[model samples]
Target: MSRIGGQLASRGCPHQVKGTTMTTQRETGTAAPHRVLILGAGYAGMAAVIQLAARTKGCEDMQVTLVNPQERFTERLRLHISATGQQVAEMNIPELLEGTDARFVRGWVTAVDADAKIVRIDDNRVLHYDTLVYGLGSVADTVTVPGVEEHAYTLNTAQDAEVLAERLARLDRGTVVVGGSGLTGVESAAEIAERYPGLNVVLLGRQEPGAAMSPKPKAYLQAALTRLGVQVRSGIEVVKVLPDSVELAGGESVAADVVLWTSGTRVSPLAAAAGLTVDEHGRIVTDATLRSVSHPDVYAVGDAAAIRQGFGVMHGTCQGGMPTGVHAAVSIVRALDGGQPKPFRFGYYHTPVSLGRHDAVVQFTHPDDSPRRVYLTGRVAARYKETVTASPWPTYGRMKKMPASGRYQRETYVGPWLPEPILTVGDTADDITNAESVSTAMLVVLETLSPLERAVFVLKEVFDFSHAEIAQAVERSETAVRQAAHRAREHVRARRPRFTADRSRQRDVTERFLAAATGGDINTLMELLSPDVTLWTDGGGKVRQALRPVVGAQTVAAWFAAIGKVTYQGVEPADMNAELVEINGGPGMVFSGLERIIATVTFDFDADGRITTIHNIANPDKLQAIAGGITRDVGTI
Candidate 1:
């Protein structure tokens, strides 16, 4: 029936091959072949190629080629472990692809031509592809910060980790400043403190460390750092990095022998240069289906894409990257087969932060950004982290041959539309609020309409397409498009009231809350807070904040009154501003003024308009987005 059948019949219908099979099958004297060019042999990219090769069993038309700079796939996720002098295992590309029908090309990609559907590798070689999957991962963002390029070292690659390990081994005792106290910072600090007990490990951030993490984990992190004798510095911005010291924004300087920069990440420049639609951080923008907005044949995955719904480009961890790769591959396969690509979806997972060798904190979060539930610390958490690190590889190995299941079948018809909506920084409109609000609005808009009506409304209203354009995009009749749009609008109007928030009332309530927080009046603070209010903070073990939720108005008032007694070297009580803003779908206040963003406060309301939960974003890393270049007057109030 097909060329694949003929080839299999000639080869005794064997599925397993002992060696590399390079035989190309021919069909009807015409080349109905499909060539997939996958870039970057990282976890996601490698998994994509392997899965494609296994699933296209009877497809004689498919050919896969994987391009990477190195011949071996180094476990990049374990760089922190490797940096701590642990022996990291390496996976050989050729050995791993022994039985697979994929070809590996060893060369660094210099340029990509999306329109031509070709990649220019080093040595001036051009490789063409019917479908191109981008999994270039990320590199250290070294721009903007002064003197960092010349002095600081990064733990981005395997080689970089090796260099760091070697440096640590040679050091007897000195100050090591770990910048940006995010997950990477925590891991690096823990590893360094454990490996070299003599060295003074200082974790520096703009806000308190572990502020973005859960309370239990934050407490665990602080305990681990204290136990390991690591110093934590918060609310200080790095003005300049020097050869032997780091200069802070408030004219303060810290002496350091080694500076490890684990700050934010930026997308690979190759994606933007290829004429792909990229965001401000150089991350390629993709539609709901994970296809590039500029090029239909090209797709971007992992740290390279800026998906809607979150800040900071969807955690650069392996968890996000792997799913993105799978989604991109599935979308490409479906598109190639003349079918509509399925939308990508993500759920929150546990975040494990290793504290040295045997201590860790595992923080679990819900899908709706709720405060963490399960908080595991010490040896148990360490073991869990290890298992998590090892689970993905074996799972990927198993997923290599998994057949592609059709669209996810649901028991109930929840409308034929993608759930989450994409959001950007400057996309403020009547319909847009924060990340969660945008996603909710999009879901509500789609859930109330039928399939055809949903498609027409999304194309015409949300995407701002013309009537003719809507018909062309969905391949529908003009009359059908008009009627669908009309019905969809009416349906949306009826269904929209449930999701709408009272912005005026929310802002007023937030301002009232702010007045109570800033006035230092315990009575006012008590009155503003609900009786059952729960507070959450992300200090990341860098700054001192509420370690646990201070429930009840009296307890919260006592906590606020205690703040007046504590004083920093230059900070004063009066130089703070708590402005009302919307965050995480609720009214919130951004606390900042004296050259630093102190905290972000969010309130959850009950049916009686009482606050149920008080969420605070004091994690300096999370606050870095709002922290601007302002000079603080260093004086007592």
Candidate 2:
């Protein structure tokens, strides 16, 4: 009776699952963003959003919108945890994109009018995009075998794993036939067997588990599975899946309480339906630069893209998928700048497979993904795999801001906000002294003036340029530049105190500020701050930094105390969360929360090591390297 009836009729009517949306269509009003619509929030799609959002933070012309069936970021890499009834972190997509100019459309993408550059979302809304990033990633192949879609389970999403987990929990003693011997199947079988020792887990596939790895690592992986009480069945095929059993090739039947299908991967059929060129597997056919060959405006990435490199067509691994996302973003930006999108080059560095939480085997590979003789095993490899699983989100955050921190030009004495500390210098560039000049409280105070006023002041006071040069640099007439410069100079001199701290005192005050902020000791902070000292906090609206400057020492000290209040319940307050960094050209303090930079606390010291002013920069863009940078201290703050 409704728009979803026909599709439900076609699939024989599977009820609405918690995390998936029906492929339904609708129309809606024109969106405000220039609309760079990304269809999937998987590895590649997420890369595109973060890269574009950070690159075009305040730009009015571009809007990055991501469409997914669920609000949570599916840690598909750790779905085995879900299969065993374990809870994983619920990473909210909308919360991640909060401070940026990106929107999250929570719905399954139903249709794409490629010719018109429009997308339909779940029979409710329509979105139009200037450019489309097609990364509606892959899922397990259920159509190849009979009854699998109706009877077996999948680890495709958080909800999918939940369905399997509930069923697994109900079974006190039963054989769980895992009908694939691939990495996902291997991990799932090992997890289930280890957790439910009362049940049997048969890993069935056409090739031996870890068949792609070298002899040593392959043996190590198989042995770990054996130790977990998993039965490995290779050189076998699953012909059918029943409610309580699986039918294999050669008419052999294995009693199965549960079956997990993780065989061949299948992409969504939307590409072919939209008239875009697709490979035999239905993945979007992409050029060297990861753009769609049939429709140049569409960039394909992640598991949904059939991208060919010098090695071969890249398989769907997060290691390779993430690079495709980044490269697509880089190419898109290049095209926007009237430049060419270059080729995407990647290599297989490592293949890490977890046997469970306690054990793993890592296969180091060559550029072509062939297994090298070298490998890692046991706890060392387990920790390495955990690190790999956790690295991507923060790494993408780092890659967002190019020409940042150590690469930009010197900043001026602006009004209230902190100046960008320093542009990184090269071996052939000027010494640290020139870069150090940009980190003073004087430069940060200059940030308070209006854009025009600040530009005129910097080009005149700091650079010592004539009014004529300042006019040209600031794109104003010499008369206007001279007038603006006079007002800026007068305002700065009035606001600035007639004081300069000695080098020794400045260093002492800076260290104390770091110690106080990290320790969250408001009493110590108040002791060092002058009664008239001011504090400015910038969250860029992404984080919870103060909305406005907190004037006076008591107010500023209270703010510092509130920051240290985040004990996260059971977690330790100080465990590599705070560090002393050389921000711009001076000693500064940086704090991190949830693997991302939360804020930067910088100080301007007076003659006797008393704090005169403090700047807190929590803007995601400004704290790009807050978590990890080349400029870290040897020990904690």
Candidate 3:
């Protein structure tokens, strides 16, 4: 028996392995062990590895191998930042596969033998496998754009980013034109504006900037670019590129020193060269399970696979990479076990854009391109974006350890039920307190109540309902609910401290909170959060989240700190206005400005003057009325 045959025999199969071809016996009592080989180490490839490893962890009958040229995973999304002189930490592939049983091979895959199930590498070695996963992400498509190949800088690799960053730092003053107004181009231009304020950044696009995004985000992006002194030129097509300037189709010349090309991406040449069914752009054509239509054993994902519409073919971006990887992995696992293949599904509800440092715009859209009701801008949205990006790795790490039952076996999960009528004053406990705080902040404000007064007043007046509702929901409340709500409000309004020790005295706490959260300042944020502060995000479970509440200032602070490390170029925090108003019964803050109310942070303070509860309202539907009224007012202004 050959190496492949022997491995299969161990899994109770009698198959003959001749080079890369497998010959099965007619009367075999078992099936051969499926061998899966994956290419690339980017998001899609890495995700495939994790899913496959988890699926075949304890199974000895399957073999999986991941091949990539690089040993580390490069965060493609943060390449713009690296190109603009911001240093980013490398995410190690080995670290990502800590306890996984997947094998990693470092080599450049030059050719694919799809029929023979063999991959030829640069080292002249052939790797034989039963199934192949093609996830060669993408490369800069600079060939079509004339002089762009020789002169323009690209944001494809880490080395490229470093080179561009050095060039940008040395330049004194000139127009830096970005040839692409898509997400990457807009993001790059925004980042450059923030870092090198002296340089004139111009963005050129064929369509209006942010055309694919919602109107709310489009407006916010335009405003943010203007605020950052970025000139946006839309409906312009580049005809010729010179050393000193770029000539448009109408023969208009724009003076430029540095030109960044982030317009488009093309599939790897390996796909077409391998004789697989490929699209015009050289992307391999894959089916619903991410398997190549030309070859059942061959799979393609990420930017390399051209999936048809209506069958869950996601084009580009990390959003598409994850699902493709998962599907490919599941396909491989099912093939190995001789089980039915599961169809691939892509889940995405919102597209988030980071504006430079602390600002962000999130646009929610339905699957059919229709605009959804949710649209968030400014600091609150920025924070939400940061939290989302950092959650996957940690969650993935934990999921690897869960039992087959899919629940934490250490403890039995209990549904929320009324235990007893405990007298809870205000929302002192972490869960109920945070929920109440957010509710208050969103409901309070009419001018009259100070920030603290507004928070307390709203919590007592609005949410202090029947004992059954309170007890069943929060697991506490009934005995002293009314008194607690009333006293919490009174305590906050009566003693108004000029400043909280958690925030810097020089800047207003609310302003700084908004600024830091938007700007991605995890350190400053940690300092601002009270010891018992809790950050609650209400995305209605439509988006990615922690699911559970993030408690304690240190823990929440650490989470934000991680966000600060992944610098999104253009996102920045905007000032939020707290108009004093009456809601429910008492006063609360009505966070509004820059067109609408992004969020309202309400607080419930303890008798000792420390903030015991804080709530952040991010549910767009819940705040629609307030936002609509504020938008109308801003339009009048």
Candidate 4:
């Protein structure tokens, strides 16, 4: 057990303090614990310590120490909410680390001596370590714009946020200028506008808020800001921040009583000062293993590390940051165990932004962080955003019990995953979608549409309902329904082509592809698939199927060919019975094992009769649609 107090004393110090150290243990011929010193207690730092501590709990040969400015874990994601006089939960970091083999030191990191392997705390105390996890994190840059450091406030810490909250509460009516139209600026402006209804909240930045999101969600975010009375001034720069106003690039001045600076990013210069290589932004430059390029003993993570991936240098984000911490912990463990650490790879998944308390927008992204066509808005998005924000604490708790839970297989899973698959099977041509019934592939595309848009599209396009009828059925304004219909149509038309294979041709193609896949004939499978064919598998995270969409004929063919040789879900290849059948007015295949439907595969083809897309649905809950038996006479194409 560790006997160190809030301030750690090291025997490595030339003066030889009263406390114990690894150097003393070595001199006495006793084995010393492998020490891992983690700096900061932010999202990244906490994740690294928790994962490492949990994994090393029963082992006495390892010790972990975490140093931070405060014991309370700051919810950086909700700092904007806190800045509006709203109360956030007080999460004690020590309490979370109580049962683990981890010690928490509450003090600001003053300096790091890389050569000595010692860290200097604000109180002049020193802590020594064998491996150092440099996750000091970053803060909002207040030194960039003139007078910003002296005049403008920033939400860099919990105290900083509370200071703004106190100031906002004291003001009866005034203008609050939020510099930087990024996500932080947008959330701040919205929160201030909602809480202080009398206050004129002006969001000033060069780019419009939600510019990184797609058009639909972007519009939704902008509309929510407008509803909250946030004055958005975009495409304009804040050259200088004054005591009572900000100077724009065009020499225009905007008056403000409270200036909240949420613009730019800056990391601590401790790494550079300690003789470690740093990037241009003062972030420690890390190799693929997340270890410092110059000093292999030091590992940098979070916003403080300039780690590069195939895409580019990773930007600061909680989504990406948490993973880096977990990866670093895993790497550290591997290295300590005499194994080489693997390279780190990550892909951005989604961007959830909150607008006030009830409204939000969630923009789905590709592995490369590019915006996908899917998004969510309004209260649903707000709930999703809230769930994501509150997940870290519980996630850490779960990690304490299950260390492997922190690991994410992002390299294999590179696409957006739906929580559940949509069942479009019906008994007749009079189904809601159309006379022919929408294929599961097309319905998958429609799943990307908003609830209102999907409703409008189905009513107007399938049932031939007029705009007035759709508006009344959906209880929406006619104009709004019209706009939704237009968007839905454009989205669908752009994704799904008007041409399709004939029923006989589709059946033949499905038969050929099934025979090739189940027979493990990769060459035949490739020949049967389009060069750009995409395979989307939905296991709902329950089954061990692919969570990502496998693209390219070669990759998909190889994947299916391998599946044919292995026993999956307790079913042997010899016991699996797959047959081509009519499903959703198209040719589909169902694989049954042990007299039960194990999975279903649907095919989508181009006009040339080449299989262009495949939807593999293995979700047990969604299999209810075809569990009993799919009627062959559902419809005639």
TM-score leader: 4
Per candidate, the number of residue pairs that clash is: 14, 18, 24, 0
Q: Once model 2 is optimally superposed onto the true structure by TM-score, how far is the C-alpha of residue 608 displaced, in angstroms? A: 31
Model 1 scores worst on lDDT over the 10 consecutive residues at 628-637
Off by over 4 Å in 1: 1-32, 309-313, 368-370, 403-637
What overall lDDT, based on C-alpha atoms, would model 3 receive against the true structure?
A: 0.62
- How does candidate 4 fare on TM-score? 0.65
Angstrom error of the Cα, residue 359, model 2: value is: 0.4
lDDT (C-alpha) at residue 97 in model 1: 71
TM-score of 1: 0.60
lDDT of 4: 0.80
In model 3, which regions exceed 4 Å deviation?
Answer: 1-33, 309-313, 402-637
Taking all chains together, each candidate's TM-score versus the true structure is 0.60, 0.62, 0.61, 0.65
Candidate 3 or 4, higher lDDT? 4
Q: What tens-digit string does per-residue lDDT give for candidate 3 at 254-276?
A: 99999998878887787787779
RMSD of each: 26.4, 21.3, 19.8, 12.8
